[model samples]
Target: MKLELPQRDVGLADDFSRSEPLRYLNLFRLTLAGLFLVAGPSLHLGSDSPTIFFGVSFAYVAAVLSFGFPDAARLLGHNRLVTVQVLVDVTSLTLIMWASGGYRSGIPILILIALAGAGLVGQGRMVLFYAAYATVAVLLENMFRLLSGRETVDFFTVGITCIGFFAIAQVARLLALRAIANENLARQRGVDLASQLRLNRQIIQDMQDGVLVVGEGGVVRQFNPQAVALLGAELREGATLGEHAPALERELRRRAEHGDSAHSLRADGSGKMLLARFLPAGEANETLVYLEDFDRIHRQIQQVKLAALGRLTASIAHEIRNPLASVYQAAELLREEKRGDMQARLIRIIGNNAQRIDRLVADVLALGRRDEALPEALPLAEFVDEFIEEFDVAESGARGVVVNRVPPGLEMAMDRAHLRQILWNLVGNARRHCSGAPAAVKIDAALRDDGRVALDVSDDGPGIAEALRAQVFEPFFTTHSKGTGLGLYISRELAEANGAVLELCVTPPAEAGTTAALPGAHFRIIGRVKP
Candidate 1:
């Protein structure tokens, strides 16, 4: 793992130091002035001491007044303000110390403020100005000491003060330059981020997909251009759930209230079907939905395909039915005649295949009609038991397929005929595909606390791959030999007619021992319980 460098341990402290130069400088100046004030009453100069200290005190008070920027300069940017304040500080220090007998008063060496300000002001001309000012002050102070002679002298101390101030001033100057450079970089980054956000918004506006941005209050804060066009909407902010697009609004509320990530929303005014891909984290209080208009596409495709299949069915019916009758009659004729064992077996095989073909054709005809259902309040426990027992799937062991544990007393409201058809499709598929597997089929149900039911009927023979799962629901889609492949397509159709959703359950990874083969598929039926 890469170790993260702490901000404060590096540039952050320097940034803070640069930003508040005046606050700290004022505090330091006040502290030094306090010391000077206290020392004032204790010192003397050739009877002129009173005048000089009074002048120094007055000058210090004037400097404090300068600390607050004038009203006109407050609106200026911080760097410029700091530069102006530093100039005021330098001028104040020069006048106060020079008029108070220069180095004689030992105040001529206070140059750290000037040094700190130099960093904020930056280099080139500013650095030279600060350096030249410091050099001049020192020379003037030393000349005063020479004129005053030994009685009030401390030349060594004066020299040390000048050296310390000059050294510290340069350090402050360099750090200030670094701070300004970093600030410029941060400003540039902000500009780039703004540009990217604008580009994203424009792209979303151009999309055919309806885009909505909702806030924490469950109000639609932003409904993009595509959303407005699709809904024929002229809505304002603060629209609540179901205000403009009821289907989408209801779904958003479902997602908000239940934290559901998947929803199918259809609105009638646009005469279009809308499927939504939702991204909801559990904590989200409002949801954004992206509408994909696949209903129009499915309808067009279904009409064209259904018409073509209708003609094909009518043409094939006579050709298939006549041959099928001949095959069945030949089998009967052979059974009536005294036949050898080989002849009898051949006749049986032909008759069985012909009958199977007839069944297949009948099933195709049934699929052509729209499924009709009569939904009624159902006891969840009774249906699961009856459906399984009536289908004879319990004798799973005879076919080498294992029936995994079943949850007892399972119940959900469902149409009896629709439920029976669904079970038949599942059992038939299990018997065919997982015939030799170790009895790996299971049917189970659970009634959740919120009155919703989840039904699972799975087989542990083979699993479907991720890539093929999407197409599994399409009509006539299958992967079996010697089969019509309409089993699941019909199963889902019946399940939906009963107001239940039938979806393919993905097989778990190999690490999950109870799951089936990687490409094997399981089916799920989900719906609400009777109120």
Candidate 2:
């Protein structure tokens, strides 16, 4: 990821460029002004042209004020501004030396300061350029003084001063480059730190367990979205935890004082069990808490157990097949031979029970090897109507016992074989349990508001007891003695595999609508509807 540094009105290098030269020049100007003002007989310093020196000092003050204006100061931008200030310093110092004492004046050394500042502000060859200009201006001023017969030229002093300017420029340039390098290095570090902080926050927010940091006084400092979901309440920063979760706050304090590492508590009103861990967050009073739902973990464990059982059952069923076929063949042979009346009846019973056991085995094997669904869009209303017709003809004695109320043109996407098996099991159960001519067995199908196809198979018989409702879909759980018990379990598994929901709904109250008053067992299947 690219590092993003914090922004500022002025950049580091640019601010250093303009501010350094301006600062040094202002100091030089003010110092010269002060010297000229105070240097006289009273200060034990005398000047040949004190009046001209004072006038030049006043002009320097005016130049300082002019550059102080916002528009004028920034007119040439940062880099150009620094260069201009250096040039002005050289010229002003040259004139000041002429006014003081021609070539012999010590003020010519002050020009070196301006050239050194240029080295700091400007880079590379520009440093040499500024030094060259300063040297030339000083020589010209001294030449003018000598030609006018004010003083004689001193060749040795001029040559040494000019060499000093170049030496100072090179030294200042090296220092400036080092300082810039340090600033750039520090800026990059800041950017990297910011990027790391962002990445850490993302990882914390996406964690599966809910996390919270709470102060000792119960105020919430931070919380993840999962914490809100698990607690069934919003946790705002700076808000008292007692307002949202009193039980949780009490538990947190208890765990910390007793030196416990973790605690489990149920959320108020929600009845969701949360396992929480308390860790000190590098502060004496602040605590970082992680919460995870106990029910979710239990459910995951339960699924793993069920999967193991399924594999075991598949292995056992394969072993039973060989012995079961042998028993069926022996029973069939006994029924074909002549026998006494009681013996004949016993043989028939054996054959009938053997066939029932065989069918049970077949169903169990089918459950073990259920095919993956290759779903297709189907007109549900038409499909159910056809199924009811076929079922009526197949079950001769159960004619007119099944009723359907599916609206025409309704559609759903489902595996045809899986759908057929699920519907057959539910409708057959309804048919077997019904006791009247009006047919309490009914298939109710409709398109729900949320774009799902809802199909409910309900009966008008006695409803399932609350105690047994929980186990209705469990494998090998059946109220009937002859039932294999894999029917509802396999049906639910198929429904889930196809991304559908199959649930046992509450039987409607007697005072409610007609369907509710029937008080039958209702199994509702909801799945995505095809457009």
Candidate 3:
């Protein structure tokens, strides 16, 4: 909440906190050197010959030189150097006090230096140490004056002068303590924030997407560790755009301007293929480009393959239905004309074999690619509910179950017709495999704050075990009691077709304490929601 410090300095931690301390150390030396240079030549020491001016200059130079060898710096010991600085300071002020009449010169100004220095360069003890030395020096000076008899003052006058010096020193010491406390707290918070940022950066880098950050003039200011490794480009803070990844740098600039460039581009970088993407990454004023690798690209290609398969299935089913009808009718006619068990057996064989072939053809066509393009917005909740209702009505719970849901006015970017098939397959599996619980099924949708619209359909029926969440999305996976297990395989393929991912949602455990959330077998579709 402190407005003076940068965000990165506010509690951000790194592997080693020494880096922060080192910065302050360097500044401490430089600032002292500058102060001495400015004040040394003009100093008169209030009629006291203190080249406080000269000795301080020597100490500042020593402090600067010490940073080059930290071990030597420590051996020199802060206590010793600070003691030397304090002796010079207090001696100079004590002489000034004697010459200008005690407590009358600008000698009190020296206390301000002690207090501010404590806050900036050292700790409370360091300031208090200086204050104590000055206090004793002032008392000793007064005692010497009384002994000399050249100083003739009433007891009350000497008392007031003593009170004044100690009072100012006391106030200055307290201020030093407060400033030291404030400074340490601020530095600690800065370290914490730095740590949080580093963690978030690691998470961003771990993602499969190639994330790049663009800065002023299209400079790659910040990027993920993954991007560097995947691209095989070793990049640092000030590296130029072209040297890291030529195509990426140019694409980001183009996107930032919103020029007449393609929204999605498949680029061939050297020998590797990359899906170029531009998004407002992490936050605004920063653009991120995510390049999908070959694995996701292959999955997308398989989705195309599935779409083709779906179209082919639909066509072949249409053709086979005519011949299937013809064969059944001819068998009926043969039964009407004959009277032998052999003829009856022959007719049944012909019908059953033809029907089985028809079913195989049906499954194959379903496996084909989905080629429909979405050009409309559908109220997501309402659409899902309507689909579930129709599924229950048209297909009984014999092959698999289907839950009913039609949330009205819920919206998402999808082809309503195509989405119907995805829901059909997903809900069907939940009903079929899930057993002994009145065909448990559920379908729901909700708006997420993260700019993704989501739909979840779960079953209390036989749930998929935890081990399979990773591999379930691959093509040809199924656990059905019947034909191909392409139901879920195809459903996921269809959902992703419109930039939506249908994932098996993970559930929290039952009896996982009172704070536990849901743990039902669930599938979700997340994507951009309609505004």
Candidate 4:
């Protein structure tokens, strides 16, 4: 997964070929030209030909000023412009050297400086060309001095000066090559770091659990969308964690002070429980906070249990089912024959216990198939009416017991069979607990503010104790002797398979001007509204 970086106008030797060194070289040339114009006459610096020396110095100043303009490099191209400037510098300095008494003058030092500048800023072997060019100019000046009947030409001094030019050029070229290599290495490392940063950010954003990077003072330095969702707060960089989620911040502080590893809290907005774990981020006073949804964690554990139980119960049910059916059939046959009351009662008990075992087996089998849900849009009002009619027929004593308060046109997205099974469990539980009166069980459906549909089932009977509320949905937990205790557990599993939540809650108050509300147990299923 290679990330494409934005394009840049980078070059191979940008560090060496930049215009900064050229500007500094031009500044040096302009200063040397000014010194010649101002001090040459008083110090007898240009005794050979003072007029020509001053003329060349003035022209050198003018050329250096022209090179300072920003557009000069663009108009003539960078390399060509630098080449032209170095040529001007060499020619002007050589002319000044000739007019200022040949090799005796110190102008050759300025020529050496210009050569070194060209080597440092110019591209490739152009430095050698400038060095050779300056050598030819020096040799021609010595020839001119001898032909004009002036003085003897010193060949040794001229050769030594020319050698110095090439030596300086070679040193500058080596330095520039090393500098460019280092610059290229640094740029490649920067690109690699940027690529890794983008890839890591994408992975964090897609994670199911929330992740937060907290620095000193509980300030949030970085967070993903899941962090915001789990905390149910609007998080931003640099915001103090205490301001958005005080409970979480407190737990983090407690863990830091006491070294406790276990802690949980409820989200402020959704009221969903979250388990928090903290780990060192390998920085000074920095922590990595991971917030996991407790319900989601439970579902994962349940799925693992269901997988193992499915395989175990499958083999056991097959074996027990055959003998159990034989026993049930024999008891039924015995009941048909003439028998005493005690014998009849024993046979009846055998048949009833056999049926309970069968129902429990069927419920266990349903748990294995919880993941096979095919969700679709369902009309809430019509579905409730059909469920109520069916329930009235199935449980004769519960006729006219369940009332549907679902508004018209309200729809939900859920698996048809799963939803039916969940409602059957909830309504059957409500029927057993509610008073034997009309409209004792109320089924209400409404759209929540978060765009999810809420289906509530409540009754008018004694509600469950607060201490036992948490155990209502656990497998194999029930108050009735004949109950399988898998009804609510399977219902919750099926609800989760369809991306919904089923939980027990406080029963809602009855309508104003209607009968007073009851204190029975309430169950709600919140799921996505039909698109």
Candidate 5:
């Protein structure tokens, strides 16, 4: 996985180190300056020492003003300005040390404090520079005091003090470097965490199953788009879940108290059988609910069952066909051998029954291979003209087949074999049932508003009853006693495999002035027009 770190703030570590330590340094300066006024007399400093104290106090007041005004710091710019301030501090402390009697006074410790502040400025070279400068000044003062006979200096004390200043500077610089590294690691971690959160949200939003997180009192804390669609309600965050889906909210709340549970229930209005699963989430009274449409699952299972049945029958059908062909040949030979009238009639019946059985076997074998359909564009006008001509030749003396005018240049995407099989079933059914003499059955085509072409096969017989409309597409449903009953079902399956629909259409209502156009059975094949 790729990690994208957040952008680092420019100079954040440097600015932080520079400003933070300066605040403390200013406080130290003020406190030390106050101590000089309060304890100068006890140390027995002469009047000249007071002048030095006053000067240091005045310099500190200017430092206080600089700290209070942001623009002053911006004008001086941190590095150059801080360097000047540190120099002032070193010079002031040296003077204070001298006035307080050199090595005898404990004020030299303030020089060490300055060195520590320099380390917090995040500049290692500057710290060393200041430390060396302070060391030289101290040594010079000690030498001057000793040589001028002002006071005796302890060389060991001066040497130890210089070492202490450099030590403090080195240790502080190491800590500053470590702090900056920690800050960078923490910033990168925050960026990765945010990226992971957004990725998880996208995955949840795109899920097919509905997901919901309901908090206390049935308030919807979080929900995905699928939840809104599956529930058939618009779910806004922070809205009470009970308002949109009361049954689901109640089920979730009940399961939250009673441990993990799953319920299969039908949603009202939508009539979708849903499998709802609830699990406890986080702390307190919260639950995660998952909703899935059980009807879709049932359909998938049914399709698998149908496919298995098709495979089993395919093997059985091939074996049965060979025996059936032998039986049909025997019946035809027996009729030709001039048996008695009753025996001849029985042979004809046997022949007809064998033919019907052969037809059924062929349909069953076709079912096993119905899933594959290689489609191509077929121009509707030309296809229909060729089909009617071939159908008339196949039907031999049958009459009254008429084709209505179709839209020009209309085309359909379909497998030629599949489309021919479906149209043959529809036209055959219409021809077998049609009652009229001159125009018993008809074929027509039109363009529908939803970007599909509708090819209609209608007859002039009584239309199917309203109660039987829903079952017309079902397998093994037939009105004819001699029919195999798999014709419409196989046709529909083939149509669907080719990205088309075969459905019953309502016959147009008769006009008040005429009984010439009576109701009839109408079926339509709806399919996409090829680009």
Candidate 6:
């Protein structure tokens, strides 16, 4: 992969760049210059020309000090600055060596150090050029000494030292190249790791199931939004999981200590049933907890089953409708003719059973058409008034039984026909079971805290038993002998198709001040509200 290096100042390199090695080379030059200034005369190291030697050493120290300034590199560029420093070192040291007594004084060895430092800091064949420059300076100084008879030449040692300079330069160059390669690899790895971290966070945030990373002490190290929503509490990183969800914490403890396989808990705020699963996080005794809504999962499974069942039942209902209509027609014709009392009673039974079969067929057919819902914004108060008028025509004796308490102008978004069907099933059931008293069955609509409109239909009759509450909406489940058992089931299906929820309210309070309490079965429809 192509890697992009961080931007540097106008002329300065970034970290692990040539600037670092150049600084070290400058420090070496300064230290060498300082030593020469303190001990040169006493040691007779520059006796040939003490004036020039000490002056050059002092100048070199000043140059090194100037190079150490922060802006020096930015002003002269890294490569150009390093070149100037190395050139100064070679010229100054050659002068000192000539002042000190040629190659015999062992002064040429210092040139080798300068060449090595140049190789480490400088790029390409530039270090070789520095080595060459130093080599020529030493040879020229030796030549001058030989001609003037100032000192022995020692050509062999001088040549060997020059060779050593070149050799050290090559070795230092190789080492610098290796170090640069490693630095680049490290930078690439850092970029890759950061990208992976961001990707993992996005994945976790987008996941439908809640995920939490818990440490050894049950402290949450990381979590996503879904975790907070599923747990029904605010959770922060580094906080103990027990503070927000004690039941979940207790379940985790039970699983850890007793090896319990159960993983279900109720949310604190929403009381939604949650299914949790835990897995090791692969480090420091950390664990990964995944939370999912159990009720949602069940509904998904039920939808899949209902989809297949709807297709089969639709075809069967179509076949039964033809024969059912013929039977009903024949029963009507027999009823119209003169007949004995026993025959008339039998005919009535036939007509009643045929009509029941027709209703069952129609309910089954409704399930098949659930996917065809066309939802729209419906004014709650107006819809309820129209529904009550229509219901009154069908059940004259049950007229005025349903008290509508929907506020004016409050609108709900749902499929008009689907919502009407759902309300019809709910109100019909309420009318059948409620006490025949004024306002015995109440229909009320209110805006819920979650921005959805809740339409409740409650009756003043004995509520459903706790044992049967769970199966109230299940298909083919019923309590009455003549009940079709699919009314609530079909209603719930239609509600879901319209993106609404139809459920039995476990504990419904009285309608506010307008009527007495409805201590009976209460069914509620929650749907989106129009702005």
TM-score of each: 0.53, 0.51, 0.41, 0.55, 0.53, 0.56
lDDT of 2 at 524: 86
- Per-residue CA lDDT of model 6 for 47-100, tens digit only, reads 888888888989989998998787887798777888898898889888888888
Worst 10 residues of 4 by lDDT: 3-12
Q: Rate the local accuracy (lDDT) of all candidates.
A: 0.63, 0.75, 0.60, 0.84, 0.75, 0.83
In terms of TM-score, how similar is model 1 to the real structure? 0.53
**In candidate 6, which residue pairs clash?**
none
**Error at 43, model 6, angstroms:** 4.9
Off by over 4 Å in 3: 1-78, 84-96, 103-274, 280-296, 299-357, 369-531
Better of 3 and 6 by lDDT: 6
Best by lDDT: 4
Worst 10 residues of 3 by lDDT: 9-18
RMSD of 2: 22.8
lDDT comparing candidate 5 with the true structure? 0.75
Error of 1 at 235 (Å): 7.2
Clashing pairs in 5: none
- Write the residue-wise lDDT of candidate 3 on 1-531 in tens digits: 543534433321221322344355456546655655566445433233345445555655664565435554367554354445445546654665565445444554553454344323333355556656666776676677678754535556545544554555556545644444466678778899999989887888688776777766666777777677556677676676677677666776677677533344434243456667666656656666666666677998899868966875675565556657767776777767766876777687677657656655555554444556463678776676567567757666432344445367667887676577777777766666555254356667767888777887777655677787776765445554333445676677667777888888677223325766454478888866752
Cα error, candidate 1, residue 201 (Å): 3.8
Q: List the residue pairs that clash in candidate 2.
A: none
Q: Per-prediction RMSD in angstroms?
A: 9.9, 22.8, 13.5, 20.6, 22.9, 20.7
Candidate 6: regions farther than 4 A off: 1-16, 42-44, 260-262, 307-531
How are the candidates ranked when ordered by TM-score, highest leading? 6, 4, 5, 1, 2, 3
lDDT of 3 at 368: 48
lDDT of 2 by residue, 1-531 (tens): 333323421233566544755576667666765665666234422255666666766766666556645566557676666666667677767777777676566666677777776777675676788889888988897788778888756867887888898999989877876676566667788888999999989988898889999997999999988888888887899998899988899998798679998999998735799998988888878999999999989999789969977875785475456546756665766667566775676566666667657757766665655557867788877888888888878787555677767778877778888888889888877777666566577777778899898888888878888999999997767887556677788889888867788888887224224553667788988998752
Model 4 segments more than 4 A misplaced: 1-17, 41-44, 149-153, 281-284, 311-531
Model 1, span 64-109: residue lDDT tens: 5565444423575545555555565565565556545566654554
Q: C-alpha displacement of 200 in model 1, angstroms?
A: 3.6
